[model samples]
Target chain A: MRSTRVTRRKLLRLGALALGSTALAACAALPTGPAKPTGEPAKTAAETTGLGSQPGPTTAPGGVPVKITFMMWAWSPENEKFERDRIELFNNSQTKVVVEPLIMPYEDMWTKLDVLVASGQAPDSVWYDYAAYKLIAKGQFLDLKPYVDNAAAMLDDSIYDQGFWKPAKMLGGDSPYALPIGGEGMNLFYNRDLFDASSEPYPTDDLTWDEYRNVAIRLTKEEGGKVVQFGTSLAWLQSWWAWVMLLWSRGVGIVDSHFSPTQCTLDTPEAIEALQFLQDLIYKDKVAPDPVQASVLSEQGGDFASGKVATMVDGGWDVVSFRSIDRFQWDIALLPKGPKGRISPFWIGGPMISKQSRNPDAAWEWTKWTAEEDGQAMIAKSGQQVTWLRKAREIAPEGAVPEHYSKRFETLNDLAPADVWSERWNEILDKVWNPEFDRFWKGEITAAELVKAIAPETTKMLQGA
Target chain B: MGRLARREALECYLFISLAVAGFLIFQAGPIGVSAFLSLTNSELVGTPAWVGLRNYSAMLHDPLFWQSLKVTVTYAVVAVPLGLALSLLVALLMNQNVRGISVFRTVYYLPSVISGVAVAVLWRWILNPEFGILNLLLGYLRIDGPNWLLDRQWALPSLILMSLWGIGGSMMIYLAGLQGIPTHLYEAVEIDGGGMWDKFAHVTIPMISPVVFFNLVTGIIWTFQEFTRVYVMTQGGPSNATLFYGLYLYRNAFRYFQMGYASALAWVLLLIILAMTLMLFRTSQLWVYYEGSVEKA
Candidate 1:
């Protein structure tokens, strides 16, 4: 019996040794090579497309001009053309670098970016949005702080708003990843024609939420048993920013006024009241269209632009697209005040250098140039965006602002920093909050119920962050 | 074997090498890698940690996984049979000796040829609650149409209805099957004083049972893997009612970067599909009519 037991033990020992060795072999085989940035981004792009190397201007002053790709989502042909023109301008103004624009549709941007980053062939510089940064921040984006620090004297640090730059650190660490390009503050854009048709006076800048609601309900018109115009429409329904702004106007948010998120304060009475107000606008008052109704009408431009909705909570960035609305006389005003104050949370996005970028120096130069006075001047001239640089805003080309709407920029004074700047903003807002809020939109749930359903999960996410 | 025979065998293998290479590289390799990944914790952005069966076990407890499974199973159950019936009905209609039958077939087949995005966009416009032509037409009939894509109760059904629009591919297959049926069989039925129902039940059904089986299996597989429409149309929204397994897997794999978990989900899906296919094959012996086979149900 003893001899048999010894033999069995030996067999077990051998099996264990073999298994260990096999595991060791697997561990060794599992891609230990560090993901090094490729020699040139353009070369990587060339390889991907099965094209021969693209020619560069040999007469460039700098040795072997750094060829880098700039990635952005071109949602429309007009946007693509505009970006292409600007890239050409950048190329003409530079000698040390040649920027190659890699424009893709907005829908494919995240998927394509993931593929690129995973394959270690990310563009040198890619358009970065704060909400999307956290998902892609894992060893993909370079810490731009060192570059910014080195070029501190040259860079106009004051050009970018402190609120705009504060959230850059929330991209996972106390290091700036992306610099501000352009930003937009929220505004209440109302149709004068709609107001005139109803003989309702135009809403004042300091109009309270109660007054705003009353006016909106009064302006809402139904003729021949069909709604000719809705009272109001709100953009960014799925974005937490909208709710955050509303809560801020009441001096609260998902988080407290710490300017950085820590926990879910959404269950508070004030937050619930704010959410209830928005909910009432859709269901009780029927002033604004429900999400489904809005989606249908918004397809024909937007509720505001389609003239189906009398008022819209829009942004300064909308001015570019809003200019195309020739059917109505529209103007912008400050967001309606809550019991506490009026607050319009600012949103900013811009170019960021990939950590995998081989040409960080050249990329930084390009990024810096993008934020420079000249670039800002061009952006301002386009009248589609709010320039970061104060100087550029001052030098905005003649007729950039509509002659009557010259004081539109005055709404900038009402801008407030968002309370939360979580990297998981995209997931929390789109995945968690919006889906639950959708139930509320469908009238399947009340405001309190919506908050009750969402708060715990949101709190967990915030705590995790 | 003779030298000539051996040479012929070699040529046959040489001709088939490209397909074998493609299968190994694209299909088999990824499948093998996914199996290995299922045992690990791979986020795709960091070093993978070996944690055997943890991902699989974790999914067992995940409410979303269970919800997605229910959604996917419901979608497959409803869509496969409905799609098969619609395609078969369309095929029967197209089989008639009518003028412009080919033109009708081509027109019916157009929706299948259109991209998923275009189809989704078209459907979005058609199903819009307020201004949609569907609702407008329904209003004319005094029927208040429900919000098709927005209402959770109606969303999945709407998708199933939209899926039926692209039944042309299967219709073409069924049409071919119908055309291939021997005329003598129908003539035999007629001579025996078989009515239309008798002929259809005895001759048509048996003759086309193989095609039906094929469509059933393929439809089940395809419906289970329906992602593009769900992603483009609803994005698994209206309170996660349309959160199909494919969309859930995609979220984990790409959006959330939980590649390892996604791989585990893939394996579970593979097993589920395999079991289903085997079950169908087992049942097929009872109903499927093979003309030349010695074994008959």
Candidate 2:
């Protein structure tokens, strides 16, 4: 007992010393912004296009120097660099429009824009999400119908008809307030090192959730009943593909067809089967971390970067971070097919135009450039952001990304459903989905109750206030 | 010569004009607009229309607003007395003529100087159930700590613990009050054959009563307005357990964009603080003893 007390005191002293430093480190790590005062947004290809050849705003007879800003998120420095190259091309080539780029945080950009637009301080243009069409109904967003019909109408029809653009185009059968920019879909990431080390059969395209579970169970090795590795987690925040798509494969939508929140269908018997399999990795099977243990490690982004888990549900962008993982070879695969025989795919974030931007024309031009094949390709290469454009299949080219990395993109693009387009889109969908989904993942609540839980809030939001 | 009076008045007005302008700009101007907003049914889309007393009537029915009020009151009640008592106890401990006392004072008060968000994030890690040092420490005592921030039942108390970490600042104020008591009074009590307890009981209580009154009133007022710490921490969640009034006001204003409703919430909060402070002053007659001839003062 005395020894325990001595050990206790020593531990506390050490913990305090560690915590003081950790706190200081946290202060240092808090994200900050630019040092200098704000300047014009980063110039885009549209603005800088044909610069020397085009007429100046006042002096030039034909070419117009349009100044515009486009807000962006979720691409690596490499991808951003490629996009920046295109922006220079546009600025140099075209005097018609000057589009600048402004980067925005992706987590919950829509609501922030909504607030901005309501206040009339919106940027000239933004890369708006499909759901940003909600602003059109409020009269906050300008109708694109006139532009789509008239001048500045060089958009591809194939891009417009893609499965993802349908809901936003109709605005749930209303008006199309936004045009498609580029997007990434979620897929399962599998670590090849773990597969070879355990001599587990690599997951195949034909595999079901059951086969996925078998792989997880087999890969899980226990020495003294503690798992060194976790199979999968029903993620709580930011990284939400595992929860959303897995549920989606079961035909449990985050919001219903009309955009009302339905109870978690993922928690239903079929969904529960998937969840129980996930839980078996933790509670019964003991192959994964519990909620507390899961959080103690780095975030999903960091863990995947370090190549810790054998398989995690990841977005099309996950491969962007795999550039440095020397410990293991990895690739993206379709989420194991559920009973639905459909791949669970979701678009990450959508761009929106601010209703209140002073340079609405400039903003529209920037928004157009975001969806253009060249712009999409540029953003993709600089950030390895796989775009949703019909031509995005050419992203990796022949020898750019390693053959293995390129193959993941092909599988993801071919097998995955084009991203779902919907209205009433905001971070609200994220809220109604998680925690309860997490509880459902833990088998704390029945799937039926989970679906019932989110219905009203979803209904109200989808209906819109 | 009489015109000199006008010149003097003009100079006096000029000197005070800047301060008055600032007060009007930052406070009075906003308040006037907010009052106007509270009477109208306004959406950010177009002009707000007059809907007198409608926002107040709506507040009565709003379940979330009431839930927020309940949480705010509970937070204020738990935090204020506990904070004051802890501060008083620490102040008493430091009042003794001990070694390196100034250094001790600085160390104890250091936490108060740390900003709210910094302290909250530190407490978040400390309170984590899985790998936090707090849980680890509690484990040595064989008490399995709850997953504090994640648990609705314990989230408020977890925030209270964070609030308590900064009580050192409040305690320092009390410490200064303690030191201000003359040593001669204790010597007088000693000459009369009074014990240390007697000296403290008679001399310390009356002398520090004014300080206690001041701290109590201000602490309650500030706690009622508390928002930032909770905003960063739980965001009033794990299912609305920590949703205080200020957070509710922010949501009504920013999230829902119901500025008029938020103004009403502000007014209600103002009235609540006024009532509580008035009650404290009314009750101050009994225990408080002031040395000045004006007893209440």
Highest lDDT, which number? 1
Across residues A354-440, which tens digit of lDDT does each residue of candidate 1 receive?
Answer: 877777666766777767666777788877567766666765543433333544466666675552555555567656787787787
lDDT of 2 by residue, A1-465 (tens): 334455877989986666544432232211121122122222221332321222222222255575666655534565556546666766665566676766644534555555455444555565554434445555565555444443232244444324445434544553446654454556667778888888877777787877777777787666686666655543422234445455556665443442333322333465545544555556776655666666665533454554557776666665656665666787766667776765545343334455555555555555555555566666556545555565555566422343355544444443333323333333344346554654654457754676567655655555563
TM-score top scorer: 1
- Per-prediction DockQ: 0.28, 0.07
- C-alpha positional error of residue B60 in candidate 2 after TM-score superposition, expressed in Å: 3.8
lDDT of 1 by residue, B1-297 (tens): 999999999999999999875665556656776788889987655668999999999987888899899999998998999999999999999999999999999999888999999989999999998888888999999999989998989998989889998899999999999998999999999999999998789988899999999999999888888899999999998788899999999888776677789889999999999999999999999999989889834
Which docking category, incorrect, acceptable, medium or high, applies to candidate 1? Answer: acceptable
What are the chain B TM-scores of all models?
0.97, 0.91
lDDT of 1: 0.76
Error of 1 at B142 (Å): 3.5
True-structure Cα RMSD, model 2: 14.0
Question: Where in model 1 is the C-alpha error above 4 Å?
Answer: A1-62, A153-163, A172-174, A224-226, A256-260, A395-408, A414-431
lDDT of each: 0.76, 0.62
